[model samples]
Target: MQVTKTALKRIVLNRLYDHLRTHYSVSLSRATFVNAEPEAHAVDAATAFRSDIEIEELQRALDRIDEGAYGTCIHCNAELPLEDIRKDPCKRICRGCEKFVF
Candidate 1:
């Protein structure tokens, strides 16, 4: 089962859309943002920014797929298991090397 670039792009876009929809709904809710203080709003903004960053990272992963680097563990250059890749589309390391990634 090959992971094509189109498949990866769809995954990234789906996640991005999910994230934005959730955030937008929260921001629109009267109870969540309307009553929040300045510090609380700042925290919410930071959280949203982090989620955006993760989505961007997934986009980079999709780009790597386009570059013919997907499924290869970045740490070991070994082909990552298809099962793991399917389970976590953003994975960059195999189970054995995952602990050492950070």
Candidate 2:
């Protein structure tokens, strides 16, 4: 079944909120591990860092949706295929941009 843009927006919002919650929990756990287990603390810190980045990206995606640019490439302004967006809501660049960057 093809997903409507509204549905895709909802999915992306849900995922963003979920990630925010996960990031908070990871941060709490990281704080606890700071003095108890150095290795675990480092791992949790890294996870929290990555989660923070993802949260930012998802927020930008939400903003793009509000601006009617959710499925458009940020670099080339190309319309991103729905399948690609479905696979990764945080994607902001088209395949062409990806190739150009690499």
Candidate 3:
């Protein structure tokens, strides 16, 4: 039996929830090549910035759920298989139409 799209949406929501719970922090480099030494704080800040980008994408995926547009290809406007969406929440292609994307 195949899982319904609504169930997959719940899974996606759970994943996003888990990711939000974990706190990932980046560290800074102390030795600078050009200057006297790189500050450790600089490295940590950069890590946080990268993590922010991930969070932004997560928010976008969540928005798709709210829009009732999850598991559908944005390009072809076709419903992607629930299994595919479950494996990759960010995937935007159905199996048959995926070839065109490449």
Segments in model 1 whose C-alpha atoms lie over 4 Å from true places: 25-51
TM-score of 3: 0.56
Q: What lDDT is reached at residue 13 by model 2? A: 56
Which candidate has the top score in TM-score? 2
lDDT of 3 at 16: 45
Q: How are the candidates ranked when ordered by lDDT, highest leading? A: 2, 1, 3
lDDT of 2: 0.62
Tens digits of per-residue lDDT for model 1 on 10-70?
Answer: 5544444455556644334433432433235532463464556665665566567677887
Write down the TM-score of every candidate: 0.57, 0.59, 0.56
TM-score of 1: 0.57
lDDT comparison, 1 vs 2, better candidate? 2
lDDT of 1: 0.59
The 10 consecutive residues of candidate 3 with the worst lDDT sum are: 29-38
Per-residue error (Å), model 1, residue 98:
1.3
Model 3 misplaced regions, further than 4 Å: 1-6, 17-51
